[model samples]
Target: MDTKFDFGEPESQNTVYIRRVATSTLPEEIREQVPDLDSMYAVHDAEGEQLALVRDRSMAFVLARQNELSPVSVH
Candidate 1:
């Protein structure tokens, strides 16, 4: 393998990723708000920084679009 591969992400200045997050993995303070739900959706930026947490996948996509960001599924 003499060639180097650039398997890196493209320049996505207006892009975001949406994925499911288990409530059990969240901090105790955040978990207390959604005790009835098992999991939720999360919106993250290109740098993998969490932007928002919503109750459903649809909502997460909607939020990204409203903010003028392209949403991609992480799964």
Candidate 2:
């Protein structure tokens, strides 16, 4: 699975949306690290600021208002 993280765009002053084109073979450990792909999962940026979780790649815009996006559950 390709683990390259593609940051799409900055939604606002303190938000950025990232897209990782991983394959079905993505490691379980990795998935375990980010179990909430559909929610605003916590990730540290280069500067290390806490960010709100957003949507997965299945949606058009990965970063939207927290209330504007739908939640997706991964098993």
Top candidate when judged by lDDT against the true structure: 1
Tens-digit lDDT track of model 1 for 1-74: 79989878765988899999999999999899999999999999988999999999999999999999999999
Clashing pairs in 1: none
* Clash pairs (backbone) in predicted model 2: 40-53, 40-54, 41-53
lDDT of model 1 at residue 74? Answer: 95
Computed on alpha carbons, the lDDT of every model, listed in order, comes to: 0.94, 0.41
| Model 2 residue 46 CA deviation in Å | 6.3
Predicted structure 1: lDDT: 0.94
Question: What TM-score goes with each of the models?
Answer: 0.84, 0.24
- State residue 44's C-alpha deviation in candidate 2, in Å: 7.4
Of candidate 2, the 10-residue stretch with the lowest lDDT total is 38-47
Candidate 2 on 1-75: residue-level lDDT in tens?
Answer: 889988886544444344343433345665677665533333223343434332344342434334353333222
Clashes of each: 0, 3
